[model samples]
Each structure stands twice: as structure tokens, then as C-alpha cells.
Target: MSLSDAAELLDVHKSTALRILQTLEAARFVRKTGAGTYVFGSGLIELSELTLGSMDLRQHAGGLLRDLQRRTGHTVHLAQLIGDEIIYVDKVDSPAFQAVQLPSRVGHAVSIYASAVGKVILAYLPRQERDRLLSHVVFERYTPTTFADRDSLEVELAGIRQRGWAVDNGEHDSYVMCVAVPVRDSRGQTVAAISVTAIEVVATLAKLEENLPLLFATARDVSAEMGHSA
Candidate 1:
């Protein structure tokens, strides 16, 4: 708000409001806009996130992941881009398909170029950061569908950025298929990805694509939980 507006709201003298706002602006608790209005600043957001420390994204997204699993009847995975690797932080299996186990598990690292979740996160990252992450990777043709070279992987990543989502197409394992969407943080960085996975016999890639709307919705909800405004 403007200085006058703030003074009226706080029931203080305009000078008092200006002094208070100046202090907050110095600490970055609030920032003044070009239009002369005050808004919450990055420092305030950082402090809030730090306060919520241990109750991280995994905990915030757990209920949404379970709900997505129930709706899709497929295995759901949440993966985060930690340093140079994409690590599986959480997994939810469909209640009805509990006996049909796949190879994925929480705390496991997934192939960055061969997995849908990994690609989706990579696709939305800044070019320098993405290149840094991929620099250490040695591409391998895990399956016929895998983008086994940096050139081909770049093309696939480009497509994902254009489409706002990604597909595994049995890339890592010929029997497994997945579709993924990016999850953003409050600053609009794609910090994580959420994917739906299923064995070929259970659901083909085409079948999983049918649930893309649900997957995207779940991602948006999870991003909101992560403090993203949109």
C-alpha cells in the first residue's frame, strides 16, 4: 500500500508509517513497487520457508500424491532434482494394484534422461543449470526408446518444454511407462516433478496420457502446497 494508505490502516501518522516501511524495506521484509505500493519481499518468503523446514515438499505433497494414485489407479512418484541427480522422494502405489510391484522406490535415484519425471524437471530448469546437471551424465541406451545421446535428449527436452509435460514411453525399462508434469516452487522454479507409472500390461503409454489432466492438476495442487501462487 502507499504510505498514506498504510498510515490510515495502522492508525499512525504518515511519518511513522514511512519510518516503519523504510526499516522493513532495508531488511527486505517488504519491497516498494514502481507504482509506489509495498509488497512482501523475497526475504520474508525465505524466512517463512525456513520456519517450515522439516515439513518439506514431500510432506506437503503426500496427501495430493495419494489422491492422485487413487484417482489414476497407477503408481505415483515424486522426484526432486537434488544437485546433479534426480532422486525419488516419495511413491504411492494404487491400492487395488498393491501386488503388482514395479522396481521404483523412495530414496532411489532415477535415470535423468530415461525417466519422465527427470526430464520434466530438467526441461523447466534454466539452460545453464540443466547443462550443468547433464554434463556429468553418461548416456546409455537402457531401452530402444531411450534418448541415449545428448543431442537426442536435448530435442526431447525441448519438446517437453514446449508441451509442458513429458512421457517415458518405456525408455528406462521396456515394460514400464510414465507421464509426468513439473512442480514449481514459490519463485516459479521447477524444483520437482510428479509422474504416474504403470507396467505395460497394466496400462500403456496411451492409457497414461489419458490421465494427463489429472496429473497436471495434481502437480498444480502440489506446487501450491510448495507456496507457488500458480
Candidate 2:
């Protein structure tokens, strides 16, 4: 709709309509095509992925996640970001950590500010929506490494995008660290993410770095299975 059309429909001023359109554009709900024209965005592809559901996607990525977990001897997570929360849809526990594995389960909730998986999700969101969501979050400290505010996280998210992955650095648990990469859909939109976490004693930052290539390879394989293209 044109700015005037939107103003007329909502009975608001033209500038107010423009601001509304700007927010929508930032959230990827709509894209301005011209001076006043707009159209849908690739984020719409997210709806199709959700409608297809998690069961089938789990089946597609389960074997790959298991393989990655075994190779690194760490917990592997497959999660989707729904709004401000990361929903754990699948997990592969490493046999080596059976005695002290993380107590994560399918459908567990994690905050976007305190997890490798969560940071990857936040890093890939449409900027306006990401900032909007960040504004509402209560920055409670889960660990000394946890982000104390949005500015700290904004810096972290920028690094994540630069490297195509994120690291928790014991932000969620004082003795645990996780490395994660985003999973994109066919339209090149990130719809989910996968990560591997391990106890700091055995899997420190160096270990996570060593496993980064493998972790990203596994993510690419899963994305390919989901019909995602470059």
C-alpha cells in the first residue's frame, strides 16, 4: 500500500503510516519496493517451514546431529527460534559424557541472550525485530560471561554474522561452552540453528574452535537435506 492508503485505512497521519511501514520492513513482514510500494519478504518462507512442522525436520537432521555429536563427544542441539525463545527440537548426547551430560531435552526453552544456539538465532533475525525483541528482555546474569545488556549482545551478534557461527563461552553454564551455526531454508533465510556443547574442563575454547569446521559441515548437510540452497 502507498503511504496515503495506509494512513486512510488506519485513520492516522501519513508520517505515522510511514513509520509503521518502516517497522514492518525492518521485521521483514513487508518490503518497500519503491517510493510507496511494498511486497512480502523472504521471512514468509518461515511460515511454510513451521507449517511443515518439526517432526519431519527432526527425522531429516537426527542422523546428522548424532554423527556430529559422536565425532566431537559433546551434546548436539537442533533448535528453532520462535519469537524470543530458542525451542530445542532435537538433541544428541555424546556417549563419552554419559556420566555428566547436560540435562537438556527436546522442547526445552533457552533465552536468546545466553546460549550459543540462541545467539545464532538472534544474530540472523531481521535487525528491527531483533532489536525490538532485545528491548523487552530482562538481562539477568546466568554466569559471569552472560551478556549484561543489549550493547554487549549486539557486539556478540555482529561477530556471529561475520564468522557464520556463535559461541557461548560458558554464558549459560559456568562450566560449559557451546558453538553453533544457523540453518537456512531454500530461500536463504535462517529458520533454525544447530550447536554442540561440552564441559569446559574437557572442551574448552580451543576444542570448540577445533570442532568448528565439523560443526558447520554438519549444519550444511542438514540444511541441504532441508532443500536449502546457497
Candidate 3:
């Protein structure tokens, strides 16, 4: 639909719609055709590929995650941010007796307000975009530890951005602890996240802190492999 039509549907002024359309066009999210009508652009298609190419990333990161797991003896996961959620693309299970068994199937979705991997991507998103998403979604509580309030969640996301990582302290699932670092593209924009999840009994905060450097290093390596850089 045209911007004016969209604006009317949303009950906004026409100029507001025009500005929104212009912004999206500038961001390459929309294309103006010969008749000045806008439609989803090639950039949106490329971004969709970047987001949904979990199989491709899994194939590429499989060996890497395995190697990392072998080196650290901890479970590793690769996930992509989709809207307000994270979808697990691949994982490497630990050989340890008490390792956490994550039910991360090929297309299972996880919440950005709860999961470490999801939070990492959300924290790096542009502030306006992040606020818009948060405004649209109800922050459902998945566990006792989940962040249920927008203000508190905003504070937490800010900290995650500053630290360059995110942690889930039994937020989405009880007895599970996770740490995640952002994976970026060549533009230095966060495109995905790499995480390690373990049973709380085996993965204490101290252990997670100790492994933080390695996790960040591995994420950087994977991002570089995907043509992403700092």
C-alpha cells in the first residue's frame, strides 16, 4: 500500500507516513518504483537471507562450535535474531555428564526479553528500533527471573550493549544458565549471536566469566568468517 494509505490505516498524518516511508527507503528497507510507489526492496530480501540462513550458518559454524566445545568441554549454540526472538541454528553438546540438554530444534523460537542470545542482538539494535519493538510486544514472563518490565529491561539491555555480551540467569528456563556474544557483519552491525548454555550446577557465573573471553573470541572469528568485522 502507499504511504498515505498506510498512514490512514494507522490513524496517523500523511506527512508522518511520508517521513516514515522516506526513512525506510533511505535505510534500503523500501524501494520507490517508477510511479513513486514503494514496495519491499532488495535490501529487505538480503536482510531476510541474513536472518533465516540458519542452515547455512549451521553448516559453516558446525565444525567451529564442535571445536570450541572440544576445547572447552561446554555446550555451544549458534542462534539468529528474528524479530523479537532468537532461533537456534546449530549447537554442540558437551561431553560432560551434567551438561544441559537444550531442546533447540531447527526452527524453535526464543524470546529476546529472556534468552541470552536474543538479548545480545536486541541490546545492539538501534535504540529507536528497539523501543518500537518493545512497545509492540508484550513482555511475557517465561520464568521467575525473566525481565517483565520495560524500564528494567531497557537498563539490562544497555548494560549488555556496554559489556558486549548477555547472560541469562535462569530467565527463560529454570536450572539453565547461558552466556552470549554478538556476531556482526562487515558493517559492524550485529547479525546473530553465539552462545554457550549449561546446567546451572555445572555452569556457575564464575565459570561463565572465565569462559567469556573465549566465547567473544569465537564469535568474532565466526563473524569474520561471515565477512563481518569490528
Q: What digit string (tens of lDDT, one per residue) describes model 3 on residues 1-230?
A: 77777798879998988988888887688888888678887778877876656666677677777887877777888888664457877778777764346656666877778888888888898989777667767877888889988888988999997888899898978777889999887788886898888877887856876888888888888888778756
Candidate 2 lDDT over 25-102, as tens digits, reads 877878888675877876667656663656667889989998887888888999986645678999887766556768
| TM-score for each candidate, following the candidate numbering | 0.75, 0.76, 0.75
Worst lDDT run of 10 residues, candidate 3, spans 97-106
Sliding window of 10 residues with minimal summed lDDT for model 1 = 46-55
Tell me model 1's lDDT, rounded to 2 decimals. 0.89
**Residue pairs clashing, model 1:** none
Model 1 ranges with Cα > 4 A deviation: 1-55, 95-100
Candidate 3 residue-wise lDDT at 172:
74
- Regions more than 4 Å wrong, model 3: 1-48, 98-100
The 10-residue segment of model 2 with minimum total lDDT is: 46-55
Candidate with better lDDT, 1 vs 3: 1
Top-scoring candidate (lDDT): 1
